[model samples]
Target: MGSKLSYYMKILLGIIMSILLYGVVVYAQSDALGHEKWEYVLEDSGDILQIAIPVSAGLITLLKEDYKGTKSLALSYGTTLALSYTFKHITKLKRPEGRNRFDSFPSAHTSSAFSGASFLQRRYGWNYGWPAYLLATIVAVSRTEGPDGYHTVWDVLGGAAMGIGSTYLFTKPYENPKLEFGLSVNRSSRILTIRYIL
Candidate 1:
């Protein structure tokens, strides 16, 4: 029960932080456009790295045969995508410039990347989480660079916050009945028994 409560509390915190971040980004958008470097190499590298999130998740799930983890990741991904697109339409903010100038409030790539990273962190541990997050950050930075300059820093930040928040809200704790285990001992008889719930 305590663990469940803690989990919900964390989700709530993520939601609050996302909302706060949205407000901050809206206010900071005016000053967020001049930081782009127009480096094609970095942008291309980030685009490639962005694919690692889903690939890594899939590899981990397959290697460990963790169906529950896969399901959690799917839920996180769906939720993040849905929310990101919904907000983009609702906000109706324009992109930095160029042909794709509309629906640029929240970057879908950044959100997807962050959602995958957040799911890995919440479901697994920081060992996998931190690296995933770093890659996600690179993806976000990539969105702000390049000739097109797809999004502003504010957009990337908002997307990241939303992605993390959505993942936290949607991904539930893993529960595998077949994997349950218990140990018991009979002191008087000097007997020890290990039990598998399945």
Candidate 2:
């Protein structure tokens, strides 16, 4: 039952991502929210998110018995970062109320937080996932908390969707395939085999 529920959640997250991606594309062309949020997102004042995301990822990786959890987290976070940066350049959307507001297509902070938190949540369950997600939410809120011309709410939303969805697709815990390792020990003229699955 638990596994089935998790699978459904993953599917729901994917659908949400698809909707958000489409929405971002359509909204980018309009000036409904202005570009002030973009400026906030780009502000380079030592992003707490940068520090927090990796830490969260590390915790999830460490707490889980399966090394594959670590690998999955790494892949999810890495892909999200790369994609976020690419979108930033490709979209060329500028920050809110900034000269280059049209250049701000994706929110990096949002992407980073979402990716890390999503991985943690799926890998370690609510106990670890809750804090990670809370921090990620803070990162999202920070975009609109100050005068930094980084991103708009819509941009953050789009980024969040991307991060969560990407991780959900790639690192889903319940659906993860099993991996087995074999070890052999020879002692006292006896042969023993040890096998573990992750």
What is the Cα-based TM-score of model 2?
0.61
**Model 1, 55: alpha-carbon shift in Å?**
2.6
The lowest-lDDT stretch of 10 consecutive residues in candidate 2 is: 37-46
lDDT of 2: 0.65
35 Cα displacement, candidate 2 (Å): 18
Clash totals in order = 0, 33
**Candidate No. with top TM-score:** 1
- What RMSD, rounded to one decimal, does every model reach? 10.4, 11.6
Q: How many backbone clashes does candidate 1 have?
A: 0
